[model samples]
Target: MSDLLANLPGRHLEAWHYTDLKALKSFAFAAPAPAAIDSALLPDLAMNRIVFVNGFLDEALSVLPAWARLSSHEATKSDLPLAILNAQHRQAGIAIDIPDDVDAGAILLISISQAGAPIALFPRHRISLGRNAKLTLIDIAQGEGVYWHNPVSEISLADAAQLSHYRLQDEAEAAFHTATIFADIAASAAYESFSLVLGGQLSRAEFHARLGGAGADIHLNAAQLLAGTQHADFTSVVSHDAPHCASRQTVKSVLAGHSRGVFQGRIEVARAAQKTDGYQMNQALLLSPHAEIDSKPELEIFADDVKCSHGATIGALDPEQIFYLRSRGIPEPEARAMLIRAFIDEALAPVTHDQARALLERAIEGAWSKLVS
Candidate 1:
């Protein structure tokens, strides 16, 4: 533990280039203590809920969905630094399995960290779907005090299965969060996910998706809203190892104050993955002069018949658009906000889940209000 703490990931590594971990070295992290949370803080979703307080399951507050069965925390085969660290102090985790051909409607998994001091919490979760099965997972993370919330999730979809995973990260203003997700999709399977980041002093959300069988598809999309001195990074890598697979990514960032945002997206197509179609695009809107954005879009293809492309754009709000809105009797503040909302709408368009969409909109509204004020 001491060695890992002393040698935390830094900017020297290409993966951590945009986000540094120097500040994390300042805190003396201890094991998280048992904490309680207000029920009102939970989202208003009409589904079974699994709540984790300080990285430990709160069985009293959690009701495992009827279509899902909970199991023990299984071993992880990850080489990433954060995942290794999570395995070190790994506590109880939520493991769920859905059988073949069953359509599991939806479930909510919420993690809340309410600590009084600087502590560290690690939560590992796994979800697997059988052949032709379908499921929707709404994962939300929010917290109260100074702490580190490092979570790792492993997801697998069998042939002909479909999984819709949505995430909302609205942690405390002083919290540090780093999440890693791994998804494996088989033939004719689809893994669609969208993550909205609105909190954490310094946070990074990384995803790795692999097309292990033919006819697989993946959609990895995300949006980040940052204010004050907050820093947020969204990085993803999609691998197409089979023929006729498709992947798409669209990321947006709204920066305010002195906040900084980063997006690094890479698409890899193997030699045998012929007829692969992959596309990635990242756009950022800087709301303040001091705000910063770093965009890196990459494509590495080894297939001759694959269509892969990547693009990135970074700019401020167009003055002409704001002026046009103001001329229509709209205030300057409202005008600017209208444009920002329009920019984010494209990324949020893919989310069709009613409750999940509402949760994201509410959080985005609150973050914009706080950012401007």
Candidate 2:
């Protein structure tokens, strides 16, 4: 364990060059102790609730729906340091299987961290949707503490399966978070994911997705609202291994105070994967002079017939738009907030779930208030 911690990636690794983890070397993190479940921390949604307190699943608090098959299981091993740490230190996790042709309304999995000391929690989740299955999942990480939350999720979608995933990371101001999602998509499968990052002192959310079969479609969208000294990184890699597959990604960040944001996205199209269509765009809005944003978009295409493109943009809010809003009787702060919200809403346009979209909008509003205050 000590060796793994010692060998963690730093600025040398191209993937983590912008957001280094060197500062964490001084913090000592023990295994998180079991904490009581607080329902108040959970989101107000009409869905099955699965609660994980200090990274351990609380069966007593979980309300399973008819389409969910839940059981205790260990996570798969991975070479990534954080994933290795999760597999080694995870106390409890759940494996959920959705039956074929079932339309599961929604399932909410909430991870809460509450400990007396600065500790670490590893939560693992594995989800598989059978052929023709449809499901919506909302994964949320929220708590009040100075701790490290490392989570890993493995997802597989069978042929024609559809999964809509929404994630919210609203940890405490002092918390550190690192989360990764590995997904394998099959033929005709549609996987859509939207993530919103609002809190945490230092955090990174990553996704590695593979289109394993033809006709598969994937959409990855994210938004980050950072203030104070908060730092957030959104990195992803989408591989098109099968022909006729499509993938799209859009990421946006609104940085204020002395906060920093990073977006690193890569799209790879294999030689055999002809007719592949891929697009990636990352944009950032810096509201303060001290705020910083790093954007990196890469495309590795081996197929000549594929259509692939990547681009990034960074700028501040449009002064003309703010002035126009203010001229209509709106205050300066409110006008700025409105423009910021509009900027983020464009990235979140792909989210189809009404409730999830509303929740994210409210979270953005709350974060904006803090930034403009």
Candidate 3:
């Protein structure tokens, strides 16, 4: 554990260049101690609920859906430093499996942290879907106090399976969060994920996905709402190893005050990955002069017959649009908020799940209020 912590990536690594971990060295974060659970942290949904208090799975509070089955498993070792840390400190985790042709309704997985001092929680989860299975997973992370929430999730989909995954991170203002998601998509499978990040003092969400079979489709989309001096980084790497696979990514950020937002997206196409289609775009709207956004979109293609493209844009609210709104009796703050919402709505258009989309929309509205105030 000490060696892994010593080798934590810093600004030296290109992947971690925009977001450095040097500040973490100054704080001594012990393993999170068990605390009283708060039911308010759980969303008021009738679907299956899985609660993890400080990284340990709470079977007493978890309510499994009819199509979902829970089991125990050992954590997988990884070369990544954060993954290694999670594997070492993780206490209890959940492994869920969905049978073929089952449409598992909304399943909520909540991770809550309540610690007195600087602490850390490493929670691990795995989801596997059989052939032709479909499921929707809503992952929420919230907490109070100064702590670190480090979570790792592994997902796999069989041939023709489909999974819609949504994640919301609204941690405490003083919290630090680092999350990693690794997904392996099979032939003809469809995997879609949308993430809304609105909290944490300094947060970084990293996603790495591999298209392991032909005709597979994957979409990775995210929105970040930041205020004050908060920093949020969304990094992703999508690898296409099979032919006829399609991948798309769209990331949007709304920054206020002195907050900083970073988007690093990479798409890789192997030599044999012919007929692969990949698209990525990132756009940011800054609400204050001191706000900043750093976007890096890269595509590495070794195949000849593949269509891949990437683009990024950063700017403030359009003065003309804001003026038009203000002329119609809308206040300056309300006009700005309206424009910001419209800008972000473009990236969120692809989300199809009703419940998930509504949740993200609400988060965006709340974020807009904070940004304008």
Candidate 4:
């Protein structure tokens, strides 16, 4: 009943400057309908899992853990344009609530979108951690055909809670995907997150994390590997409204063909957050002359005693290094891949979950196999 384009963000806005939505206006997206996919296509990760197909829950394929449940969507309080769009068509999402002092091992949230007429899907998911609770969440997005997958996740961490969040975005070559995450962390809570962007025609992932209590902290790290004409964007805004809080971000992008990558990160420290420690870095490696990358890192501080910094770098692979590897009898394609793996090693360090780490690394390997040689 509502007009979807009424509030769609475009290049005119600074947030969407590098990424545009004008192409979306051309499609008449029908509501998401049921679609089937082969189980073989799913990743071989070992974890309690839930599956969503075309925005609808596939109960038959889901294996929920004790800490997760099928529940009504939690209304989001986000005013971001992407969140607002997701809220409009949100159907169902799983809610994971870990009580105090519990360690819920690992949970996998898999989204599979099959090919069909142009459609749009919005899935709203929630995660909550009680005092001192711990959890590892692996979120994988993979799909086929032309469509838009817009999802929103709301996270809450009580005092002293620790959460390791790993996300992999591997949408279809013709699909458009946008994911918005809102995290509220309490005193002494830590949210460690890493996202790997490998697919999607035009995609963007945005994070809004707020340190609401003293001593809270966050680590946001991501890597984007793209080829062809693909476009991907990683945007994050971290706010420190409480004292003694800290935030760190390191994002890397590897571009080939004419693909483009964008990273926008901002850390805001309030006057009362005197002990805040914030740092951000964005780096990119260009494999083609036509490839492009945009990096924007910012720090806004009102606290006189806070330590905050931000920086960015964009460059191509070192020709001398490639020549040296060749002199050592290494092939060009393999050498390039080796350097890329080394470039992203720091970004992957925060991924402590062995299985999830392997899965993400494998995906990158697969991408490069097709891209190089």
Candidate 5:
């Protein structure tokens, strides 16, 4: 840690601490550039909405349904980590709410601008789903140059509520991003999340979910494609505290060029969580000698009669599979790409949007071509 970082308390740390201090000091520090929004960035989606551009709330572009509420607050007032960064800088993000008993859909749009400056920005969001309410959230992040973006999202679920969240990150070479999402689940509530990391210099998304009531259910799945010198990390922690609760997670990544990838997952079943069912799996593909991947999956069960399992695999393209395709007259590069695609298809199976999955597959195929050629 630099003297600047050591002197700055985590809460009182300066904006430079929000990102790599060395990078910011070595380079000319520039204020974050504004992210421009395209007209109709989101078509008439069924859900209520909150929009943030360049980490700042854009009320004019947000659509607050009659059943929903949204606002931006000083970080010190909330449990979120924003205060740790905000105490030293301005609040660059916003908060969101969905009242109980409201049959509404909600989406929060987060975007980055095309400005050619390395920068750092923070965003904070909070959501609550009332009894029996249903919500769908779509979050997107993109940028132009090398920059750092750190975001935190917190959610609370009431009895019988359901939440579906989708996240996409597609940034340029100079971009680095880290995001953390925390959720509290009520009895019989459900939380399903799907995330995609397609581009960035360094990107990591952390998810923590806890069952606060009996019989809660949670499902999380993520896929990442790393090319060039880009890197990505997907970390998750799931805890089952109530009896009969269930949780499952599957994460996958493809590493090419000199890129690196990481996946760390943990599932914990408390003593009271009897009859819990927890499962986790992580798999990776390395397409080049210089590409690297690391995975760690763990299960801690204190309850008797609970079923839990965790597994991880890291490997390169299977030569036998590649030969089979090459023997069919396909070029070596194409054959290898096909095999790797098949290996990763299972990770994308849960994606609800066909178009999004297709776009991701196309991106993966393009990455393979670049790596092999």
Candidate 6:
């Protein structure tokens, strides 16, 4: 795997890069295995499952479903330090292929049982949805001790195909995680992503999406809850390369204690992307005097005939909304929670699956309860 370290960009720790190389130089590659597996909490999932315990792939706990194809190799293909993580550490990973016109579901569960000082783990994944195929993916990342998880995932959508991605990161208090994801949407294709980040000392998720064909549509929504000194960043760049494409993005963050959150979104409509429509917004709620949030929403349009707009709001909870709920015999804490939940309801409301939506709603409420209680 030393070939992966060939002539490439220098590793730099920037706000945009999200990983510190000095902190990732410790762990020596060992075979992957989970210390324990919680069978009850995990249900039977349709998509292939890849489990990584202690920064290595755990073959025993992973299942490659019949409808998918898997392969593993040590090579650098992406353009960032974090994107080609498995190549750098000689760690094992899986590549998934969904056959044409096939409909299925899969989940990848990655956990770190013991992360020692200066240890970093990278989990690399690739997914391809064939023409008219559909798929749903769930990703969960957890780490123990003071560690770093630099993960990268790429997805390509064929004509009329649809992909839905759901990700949850609940690492240990001392762990730091950064993820980069790229999606290419084809004609009449659709892509949707929903993310929840509740646990991490510092976490960042970056997304790059392109509408490569006409009639493409993409929807991106994320909710982040940070407490204490934790920090979370969500950044996305969406480009419309074809005419008649549409995209929408909305992000909501709740910060308490001394935690900080950042949201950056950019939407571009190219000269060829006439008749394109895109919208983006970022909103935050500060639960403590020390909490802080930074939001940047922007739009660049080269097409003379297009509609695009962006909005951002960073403030505390509404007094009137809290009072209205409190006047209805609700307790002060409960009223505040209710108002905060309402602020996030717009993103959760569009989710069609009851179970998935319920899970996210519960996680959001749990974070609020922890902050207020």
Q: Which ten residues in a row have the lowest lDDT in candidate 3?
A: 64-73
Q: What is the C-alpha lDDT profile of model 5 across 164-280, one tens digit per residue?
A: 777878766677677778888999999888887887777778788998788899888887878787778787889999988888888878888888888878898899999998988
Please give the clash total of every predicted structure, in order. 0, 0, 0, 0, 4, 2
RMSD of each: 1.3, 1.5, 1.7, 1.3, 4.6, 3.7
lDDT tens digits by residue: candidate 1, 1-373 = 3454775787889999999978888788888877777888888899888999898778788889765544457657787888888887777778878899999888899999997878888888888999999888999999988888998899999999999899999999999999999999999999989999999999999998999999999988888989999999999989999999999898999999999999998889999999999989899998899999999888899999988888888888999998998899998877877888888888886688898888888888877685555
Give the higher-TM-score candidate: 3 or 4. Answer: 4
Give the C-alpha miss distance for residue 277 in model 2, angstroms. Answer: 0.8
Best by lDDT: 4
**Tens digit per residue, CA lDDT, model 6, 104-146:** 7545554554655445566666788899988777777765677
lDDT on C-alpha atoms for all candidate structures: 0.88, 0.86, 0.86, 0.89, 0.71, 0.74
TM-score of each: 0.97, 0.96, 0.95, 0.97, 0.83, 0.86
Please give, for residues 134-252, the per-residue lDDT of candidate 3 as tens digits. Answer: 98898889888888888888999999999998899989898989999999999999999888899999999999899999999998988898999999999999999999999999999
Deviation in angstroms for 289 in model 2? 1.2
Which candidate, 3 or 5, would have the higher lDDT against the true structure?
3
Model 2 local distance difference test score: 0.86
Question: What range of 10 consecutive residues in model 2 has the weakest lDDT sum?
Answer: 65-74
Off by over 4 Å in 6: 1-48, 73-76, 84-87, 106-113, 116-118
Candidate 5: how many backbone clashes?
4
Query: Which ten residues in a row are the worst by lDDT in model 6?
Result: 1-10
Pairs with steric clashes in candidate 4: none
**Model 5 lDDT, residue 301, Cα:** 84
Model 2: per-residue Cα lDDT over 1-373, one tens digit each: 3443676677888888988877667677777777786676677888788888887767788897765544457677677777877777775666778988888778888888886778787777888999999988888888887888888889999999999999999998899899989999999999999999998999999999999999999999999999999999999999999999999998999999999999999999999899999999899999999999999999999999999888889999888998999999999999998888888887787678888888887788788787776
